[model samples]
Target: MKKRIIAVLMSFVAVLTLSACTETVVELNTVSMFGGTDANRVVYESTIYAFENEHNIRVKDKSQSSDEEWKSTVISNFNTGNEPDVLQFFTGETAKPFVDAGLVMSIEDIRKEYPDYAKNIDDSVLGTHSVPTTGFVEGIFVNLDHFKSNEAKAYLDKDVWTWDEFKALCAKLVEDNADVEGYKPIAYGQNIPHYWIDHLVAAQLGPDYYNVIKGAEGEDKLTNALLKLSEIKDYLSYDETEEFSSQAFLDGKYTFQLDGSWFGGRIELENITVYPFPVVNEEYGSPLLSGFTSGFYITKKAWDNPKKRDLAVKFVEAMTSRETLTKFVTYGGGFAADSEAKPQNETKVQEALRLVSPRADFVVLPLGDASVAGTYAGLVEVQASFVNNQADTAKAAVKTYIEGQTD
Candidate 1:
């Protein structure tokens, strides 16, 4: 009888142990575009660690380093019905196919269910990711030390300036800093000159010109914009490669850099500033190039799993929380979708947030992506030739490029 009692007790203990093991086996799979850089990776890993600690759940992180690779991986996974529980992807038109296929959960419904999670996040930003074709802003990064050293602080200090005044200031900076070896008024990548010229054309003309630029009458406008940008080619620090230009900007060799907000954390500059491309038309405010929205999306697989759904939501909440988003902004130097998350220790990002107007005319740059108006390979090539002192061929090149696009 004593031996029977001992066996029964041992069986009971074994059953309890099996139940505990089953309870602790909950797992959440995740993938993101944040694995490319050290700063981004550190922040992402810390967030994951905190979430895992708090929830006592296993997080299977499958993040990819390359943006192109990440996109391909996610798309393939989604199509194969093997996508992770949570995904970080380009929001806007890029996400539409996934949404249409019912792969993404309704974040709106999630917000309704978890009001605490949605609190303080900007409605516009949330909407941008939730809806189709909604976008975000792009602007320039300035080296504050270079600006102050060249006595061109007034251009940024003042609220507004005309096209001519902006040009004169750039010219003056080049002339004033001519004695400084390797110094240039502007630093920009050869591969992305079209990105800079797009902003210039939008500022000089208006956002409407983007739609009109492919027409026959738009040839003159395109030529004029090209000529205006070409005027500063002599004042620009020309590098054989894009990476060199970015390095030159960080080394204080250039006063102005036309790049998106991501540039803030990429460089180690102590004093940097950010501004919208200055306005040329007084009737319109600064022309902002609206880029694709990028954010997290909950996969249908995660949402359908009753056991893991709430845990996934909690992870999203932790990732998008003001504290986490603030860390991203402070370290990565990009605007956060969380409205209440203020940037700390990043002056350039702070100034950019302050300067960018909600009321500004937001236009999409014609990057070859699906979100923008359309892509013209010839447009980029012609701009390059114009900047390289082949100005005489630029107008004809521009015409040919537009014609090809129209055809």
Candidate 2:
């Protein structure tokens, strides 16, 4: 009888152990995602927190110092087969290499599962960034309150203006507002190349940059664009002599500066407003525009790990969701790539959208070629040369730079 009791007690203990094992919480898988930028950090943090609360999973988010650092780290991890489950990568030829390298997994299946993809993201944006994969939208940020209707009408109405017209407008603003302390017409610093690569290229080329660069014999057109850009060298901003564009905008100095929409709220002053880039050559013909969009890519290894893959997709969906996207734009300031993510306050968001909206005659493409940084650097060189009356060498300096970029 005592032996029977002992056996029964042992069985009871085994049952309790099994029951405890069954109830043990299997932690939902954790995923590491890549993000960069202050605005991105804020939006991503909120999104991740929301996702974690909803799904009982922890996210390891790593924000890089810069876009380049993010790319390098992601690419290195991918090569080592230890890439983050999700990566925030820029769209275009820049991303093409990774996709071609078999590093990025195709999201064709994911897109199909989410039918709202097309409805939310515009077709043009899809063509540029995603159709083959996922696409992105590049948003140009403009300051509205600084220019106001009196000064902005000319640029916005025509949508596109010649290089001469652009310079004339800047000069006119400076001339009109000379009494205002440190009131420069516009500002961009030596740090970025867009003043030349994106904005000035369209005005300088007097045609679509894509048409020229993708042409069979595109050198002449490229050279022409280079020359035309050189012509308007004076109009470009000088951060040192003038106020930094962001500082100037904050100080109510310049009418405008070209930047990504993501920078809208942080850099925007209470009195200042935002808009898109204007048409480059409205009178003659619209010039091509350029933009850069940012998004996430998943790795094949991530796919193999079902939990990791699911987590990654969930993160992407969460981050790019209508709700999250709206919040992102509200704080971040770029055009909502998602259909459901339209601006909450039209007055604030719409103004920036209108500036970058597609026009019939105008075109938009990516900036940066082999000599990508040359245009801006060259512009500064020529501007200094001109200001100092070093005319003899300015033309030669410009020629050397334009030619140097191709080789």
Candidate number of the best TM-score: 1
Candidate 2 lDDT by residue in tens digits, 1-407:
99999999999999999898756522332222234345646767777788878876666666664556656665676677666666666665566666778776665655655545434443334433232112223343444554534664466566545545667776766666667775656665655544445554554454445554545545544444445444444555557532356666656566666654445545545544443344455543543343425565666666667566666666666766667767766775556555346556656545544344443244446444434564536645454554344545555654555555442
Worst ten in a row by lDDT for model 2: 128-137
What TM-score does each of the candidates earn?
Answer: 0.61, 0.56
| Candidate 1 clash pair list | none
Give the runs in model 1 whose Cα sits over 4 Å from its true position.
6-10, 13-25, 34-39, 67-70, 91-96, 106-127, 130-195, 201-272, 279-294, 304-306, 326-377, 380-399, 403-407
| Global lDDT of model 1 | 0.68
- Root-mean-square deviation of every model: 6.9, 7.5
* Model 1, position 201: C-alpha lDDT score: 68
